[model samples]
Target: MNTAKSTLVACCQLAPKIGDLAYNRSLTERAIRSAALRGAQVVVLPELVQSGYLFADRNEALALAETRDGPTLRLWQALARELNLVVVGGFCEHLGGDDLANSAALIDAQGVRAVYRKAHLWDAEKEIFTAGSEAPPVIETVHGRIGMLICYDLEFPEWVRLPALAGADLLCAPVNWPDGPRPQTERPAEVLRVQANASVNRLFIAACDRYGHERGVGWVQGSVIVDADGYPVAGPAEQGGEQILLATLNLAEARNKRISERNDLHRDRRPHLYGMDSSLD
Candidate 1:
């Protein structure tokens, strides 16, 4: 009996219309159901996918934001129960009294397990969303220990470290990587960052990105599922349109953070020497 622990993870890279709450919800519903049909134990979607990115102004963003109990989350919760798969997707969070956040929810068969708000804001996001002060939440699911984060939050190694340190086997990031200039025939720098983060933590990472130009902005469409060794198992997508990338990951691999026999990834950490206002966490 080969009992190696593994799970099929899917990154549903699709475009969500700006300010079209109904359309976005329908888009995600299709993607989630499709992923579940394809044997995905976990499905991930793009950043701010509940509404869309590139809001015209605060008024526009506020109009699109949804509370946790809103229709979108309710639909996701229903799907999670019916399909019995984990869903990690981003949304424009309405944090009562006009405050908004770039948030992602982790849901399983039981219900909405956790909601992580984006801590690091990107360009225009600083103007519209309130940055979350809370650290990323790691929840134990039937598949494995799962952690959640949104786009720019993945850029901060310290932030990613928190979940890994807390014993998360996999990290799901919902991203909307705007198209940017890079060298010809080279991978997107954003994709490279996901690989780097996974390797450092020896944790599996699934980052789902969006496509379709939104309000004059094009996206990278670099959805990917990387293994603990930092290599792409599914995709850094072809950069065309929408795509569904899937990979089966050995969740047990993350438990052994050994690159070399003597060098353990977490055990060899020199954090105390890295200068901080520490009571030595």
Candidate 2:
């Protein structure tokens, strides 16, 4: 466990409107620049950060989707190289001839590194986006080995666990969590869900989220960072403004914490006994 290396990570939590690609792009570029100026080596933005969350209808959603190698990627590549930074964010990918995929992409000092399409679609998503067939891949970078997952994927424990098992040091989640119309009491459940996920996985997690109303759709404004111990080390910006969640991510700490006695949950799991959709039961 080499506790020698550390990297600064930033999560940009901002608001963008649905179908407003130009505005969304500007928002992201500004956030990237801000993060870089703040000395963040790794900067993350919310899911569909390029094109605001358009969950209404399939046709409308697909129209806003862009290809992996499209103009959007090129722009991100240029920015990543110029800033010499790692940029992770979500987008609606246009697959052409097939249905579009809700995808997350990683861009670094080199260029577009790898992409992960959302495997688990939520509610109205099933009608607009096709479920990604490929599994998530962990890519090694200057900072550490990183993995990408879109919004709803973080809710499942195995989604984070499998990647960690494959040597993922950081899990980047680009989310567009909706804000319920109910009282503040209901929001705590969502916050606790992220904390539990981070703690159980013993992995560093960063979530960049969309805020404000888009296409009249309300969103959960807080973008947060959870440490290896499953604690909210940074965010939950409930106040009423855009902000960045900055934190020092020590890759070595993940390994040390995982092996520590404080969390035997990882070591004590019995796969044989809990096989085949056991979580469903």
Candidate 3:
């Protein structure tokens, strides 16, 4: 296996206006260019970046949704080629007919590499989008094996573990975190969850979240980049503003899931003893 020496990852936190495709595209493009100029090999943007979140209804979401070969993604493909970097971001995906899915696409110089539809829908999203059936795939790239999940998927431990078992070096999460209570000194609970997931999997996690209020909904702007040890390397950025968090990660280190000589996060799993049948009952 060809392990990456080191890869610079960036998470872009920006507020997208609801129903404003052009403005969102401009913001996304500028962020991508800026991150690329800063030597980021992989740049991740917030969920529903092009179409924005907080849609009023299913009809409104469908109006903003784009197909896989749509203009927004085409622009990303062009930028990926020009910048020679990988870009991962979320969008409202049109799945033909009346179907729409909240999806994230991984784009590189060669074009769209993989697309992951959000498997778990949250709140009003359940009313506007269809849940994706497939799990995120581990994609091979020059930098490393990349996996993806959207906002709510990160909450599921099984979802995170699947990618780790598949040998993913990095997990990109495009999120639109809703506002919630947090302690004065402690990080947001969502940020802590990503850190724990990254630490347990021994992989890097870059969560790109948006800030500000949209359509009467407030967001938690706790974008972060966590290393294999489950510590924040870059953010937990301030709320209600745009920010970019950058960090260089050793992809090779993620391949080592062993905490010590006797323990391995992956190898030590006792699936047989977990009683899957009983859990189902």
Which candidate comes out best when scored by TM-score?
Answer: 1
Instruction: State the TM-score for model 3.
Output: 0.96
lDDT of 3 at 148: 95
Q: Candidate 3, after superposition: displacement of residue 254 in Å?
A: 0.5
Which prediction has more favorable lDDT, 1 or 2? 1
* Predicted candidate 3 versus true structure: per-residue lDDT over 110-143, tens digit per residue: 9999999999999999998999989798899889
How far residue 65's Cα lies from its native spot in candidate 2, in Å, is 1.3
Which is superior by TM-score, 1 or 2?
Answer: 1
Q: By TM-score, how accurate is candidate 2?
A: 0.91
Against the hidden reference, what TM-scores do the models get? 0.97, 0.91, 0.96
In candidate 1, where is summed lDDT lowest over 10 consecutive residues?
272-281
User: Per-residue lDDT for 103 in model 1?
Assistant: 96
Say which candidate scores most in lDDT: 1
Better of 1 and 3 by lDDT: 1
Candidate 3 runs further than 4 Å off: 1-4, 276-281
Candidate 1 segments exceeding 4 Å error: 1-3, 277-281
